[model samples]
Target: MLAVESRFTGASGLDAMGAAVADALVPQRLQTPDPHRFTASVTSVDLGSVQLVRASAPPMRSVRPVGSPARPDGAAFLLLGRGARGEIAGGGVSAPVDPDHLVLIPGDAAFEVTYPERVEVVFVALDAPGALRLGLAVSGPLRGLALPAAGRALLAPALDAVQAAAAAATPADVADLAEVVEGALGVAVRAAAEPVADPRAAVRAAALRLVDRHLRDPDLGPGWLAACLHLSPSTLHRAFRAGEETVAAMVRRRRVEAVARDLTGPAPGPGVSELAARYGFAGGSHLATAFRARYALSPAEYRARHGSAHHLRRS
Candidate 1:
C-alpha cells in the first residue's frame, strides 16, 4: 500500500482533484457542483489496502457523485465538522446529515453533499479485503451515526496530531500517517460499536460526560441539557426513566459524588459554597444537607476524615 497527501487552495476546482485521487486510490469521478462557490483541498491521501483523505471546503456549495454508481471496490468514512449539512443519495435511499453527525458512504453508491458553510471533513477509504479483516464494510449504503461524547473526546487529540503532521510532513512519512489514521479509525469504530449501552442510560451517562467536558459552565443544568440533546423537558424525563433513574436524582448524585472524590484528595478542594454552586447546588446549606444524608458527614468532616485516613495509610 502507498500514501499520498495533497493540498489545494485558492482553486475552486476541487472536484477534479478528488476525482483524480479517487481514480488512483479507488475508482470514482467527482461530479460537478450544483450551484455555489466551491473550494476544496485534499490534505492527505493514504493508498494501501485502505486509503484515507482529509479534505476541507469553503462555504456555500454542494458536491455529488456523478450517477447511481456501484459501490466502489472500497469503503469511505467521513468525519465532518463546522456545521456542514448534506444528503447521501444511493442504494435507493437518501439520507440527510448535519454537523453533529458522521456519515459513512459506500464507494459504489452515487451521492451528493451540500454544504451551506465552510466545512472540514476527513474521508477514509478502506479496501474490501482490508475492511473485511477489520470486520467492517468497505462499501454499502449510507449510515449516519451521532458521534458519542467519548468518541469526540478521543477524536479531538488525534485530529490535532493529524493537522500538525499535515503542516510538516513528507511524502515518505506514509508509515507515520498510516499509524495515526489507523488509531483514529479504531477509536471511532469502538465508540460506534458500544453506542450508549441503552438510550435511557445514555441520558445520565451523557449528562455526566457533559459535566466532565464542561465543568466550568455555570449554566449547565437540565435546561441546557434539554436543548443540547434536542429533547423536551418531559421527554428528557422519560428518557431518564428508561434508565430507571430521574434527572434530578442523577444530577445531585453525580454532583455530590464529584465533591466527595475531590474531598478525598490531599489538598482541600474548592470552597463548600463554591463547590456546591459548581455542581449546581442551591446553597451551602443545601449541599450540606445532601452530603450528610448521603455520606453521614458534612463536606468539611468528610474532607477531614479523608485526610486523616490518607495520613494513617501513609504511616
Candidate 2:
C-alpha cells in the first residue's frame, strides 16, 4: 500500500495538483475557491489489471466539461466517498456521494463533481474491455449509476480485498485478487441498472464495436464509420456528441494505446518504426510524437522502463 504507490503531497498550485491527479486517476479540470490556500494529496497503486487511487482535498469542483478531450485510455471509475459529502452532475445522471452507496461513472463521460467540504475519495479504475467483460454496461449517455443495496453488498467485500492487497500483497497475489474483483464487479453490474434504451447510445456502441475491429485500417475514419453503420456522417458524429470525442479521435487513441501495449508487453517483436507502420503511423517519429502526447514518454524510453525480459535485454 505505502510502497509501490505514486504519491503527491503539498501541491501549492492548481495546475500542479491537476496534473498529479490526472496521472493518478483520470484527467479533469480542478478548481477551488481559494487557490492560494489550496492543498491536495493523491496516492495511487497500479495492480496491473486495475488501479487504486485515494485523494484528499479541500472544497473544490472537478469538471470534465462537455467537448473537452476525452481520456485517452478511456477508463471508467468506481468511486467510494470516504469523508465529507459531494454531488456529481452531468452525462445525463446526477447523484450524491456518501459512504452508504457506491457510484459508477462510465468511461470518458463528461461530468462535474463538487466537494462541499474537505473530501476524501477512493477510486478503482477499470479499462473499457474489462468492464464490458465483467457485464458492466459502458454504453448509453454518460451517466453515474448508484449501486443498489443488494449490489453494494456484492461489491463491497471485493473492494475491501483490493484495499488490503494494496497494503502488502505480492504482484502475483494482487493479480489474482484483481480477477476476483472483476468477477464480483460483473455480478454487481448486472444487478445495478437496466440497459439504457437511448438510440444515440446504441449507435455509439455499434460504431465503437466496429472501430475496435477496424482499428488497424488506415482508412478508418468518420466517413468510413458512417458508411458501415448505414448512418449519415453527421448522425454518426452526433452519436458521440455527449461523450466529448470525435470518431477519428477515438480511433487514433485506440490505435496509439494498442501500439503502447505492444511496446510494453512481455515478449519483444517489431522495431518502433515497424510498429508505427503497423498501427497506421507514418514512421517511428510520428508514433513517438503521438505516444508522448498521451503517455509523456518516447517509445524507446517507455519500453526500457516498463517492458519485460526481452525489452530489458534489448535495452
TM-score of each: 0.47, 0.58
Misplaced by over 4 Å in model 1 are: 1-15, 18-38, 59-74, 92-99, 166-173, 194-315
lDDT of each: 0.58, 0.71
What total of clashing residue pairs does each candidate reach?
5, 1
lDDT score, candidate 2, position 13: 63
Q: Over 4 Å off in model 2, which ranges? A: 1-14, 72-74, 193-315
Clashing pairs in 1: 70-108, 71-108, 72-107, 72-108, 75-138
lDDT digits (tens) for residues 1-315 of candidate 2: 422434333435677778877776667999888877777777676775577777788899999877665443334677877789998887677777766556777666778999989998877787644554454555444444567787677676677667666678766676677787777776666666645335566566766777787778888889987776557899878878867688877887888888778877766556777787788887878888988988998777777777763352222
CA shift at 112, candidate 2, in angstroms? 0.9
Candidate 1 matches the true fold with a TM-score of 0.47
lDDT of 1 by residue, 38-133 (tens): 456665554344455565666533444556344333344554453466555556666555545556665555555655556666666664433432
**Top model number, lDDT:** 2
